[model samples]
Target: MEKIATIGLDIAKSVFQVHGVDAAGEVVVRKRLSRARVIPFFAKLPRCLVGIEACSNSHHWARELIALGHDVRLMPAQYAKPYVKRGKNDAADAEAICEAVSALWLKKTRKVPLQPRKFLDFCWYQVNFLENNISISGG
Candidate 1:
């Protein structure tokens, strides 16, 4: 079996799709894993780069993967969308993310360094904005 150099993971509520490629960009692994098995699966593989579409749960997963020694990158969904060559599906999306993450363009953008303080600030700002809007609307 070829050693996986990069992996794209499309995570959802229950199931997750994985797309892996070797250093030469050839697909090596494509499969679906349940939420409970994600960590265990990655734990067994040699450390590799993992790409995940930016979403609510992405940061959580990114931290988890990073803890296991894999380099994890979070690319905005829009960035990954352009790489999708087929219909919209978890598998296809995962493949797209893999390609997008490994593309040269990805190197040009600033990597998302997940920070708890930043996330908290954003959440607090949202809550304050919503509260102010509700009071003004009397709703």
Candidate 2:
């Protein structure tokens, strides 16, 4: 089997947990990073495959990571769920993501295409505007 380095990221609104494995499938690093620091932290890492769950804001981070010269793969959260052990937490989720990506069956996992930032941002702004308008009318 070909060896490859991979980093699994469990992203959230503010904090993100990362699990990194080397070519030998040995864990090289595991840490929690804040949203503000995610890009900068990965930017310093050696080029490797970065796995993330396909959820809100995932494509944004994936694009940023790819722009920094790292390969990024987006896996569905359901596909990654089976890898989780008894304990469920951010660190566990990150480790599960890494394990899932390394599995031979990972080829079957669905890959989420990256979303355009401009389009996503525009949608968010529209939603916020609608919410604000509703609040004003209700008040």
Candidate 3:
């Protein structure tokens, strides 16, 4: 089996789809694992990078994967959308995320370190805007 340089996981309620690729952007692993098998499966592999769509449960899964020694990153769903080559499904979504994470354009933009408070400020602005809109317009 080719060593997995990165793996993209499509989280679901029961069956989780996983897609892995090698450094050359070749598919290495693709399967659907039951919720119970996620950690044990990842534990067997050598430490590798994992990309997961940023959803409500993603942080929880990310922590679990990190504990298994894999480097994990959360990517918003929209970032992974353009990579999907076919119809929507867990398998395709996993493949899309797998492709998105390894996109070369990312190399150009990842030069700067991301600050946590920038995310906080973005969230604050969103909430304040919503509150003010609701209060003044009564919509």
lDDT of each: 0.89, 0.83, 0.83
Per-residue lDDT of 14-64 in model 1, one digit per residue for the tens? 999999999999999999999999999999989998999988988899988
TM-scores for candidates 1 onward, in order: 0.79, 0.75, 0.75
Which has the better TM-score: candidate 1, or candidate 2?
Answer: 1
TM-score, cand. 3 vs. native? 0.75
Candidate with more favorable, higher lDDT: 1 or 3 = 1
lDDT of 2 at 121: 96
Off by over 4 Å in 3: 107-139
Q: What is the C-alpha RMSD, rounded to one decimal, of candidate 2?
A: 8.0
Q: In model 1, which runs have C-alpha deviations exceeding 4 angstroms? A: 108-139
lDDT value, residue 102 of candidate 2: 75
lDDT of 1 at 90: 97
Candidate 1 overall lDDT versus native: 0.89
Itemize residue pairs with steric clashes in candidate 1.
none
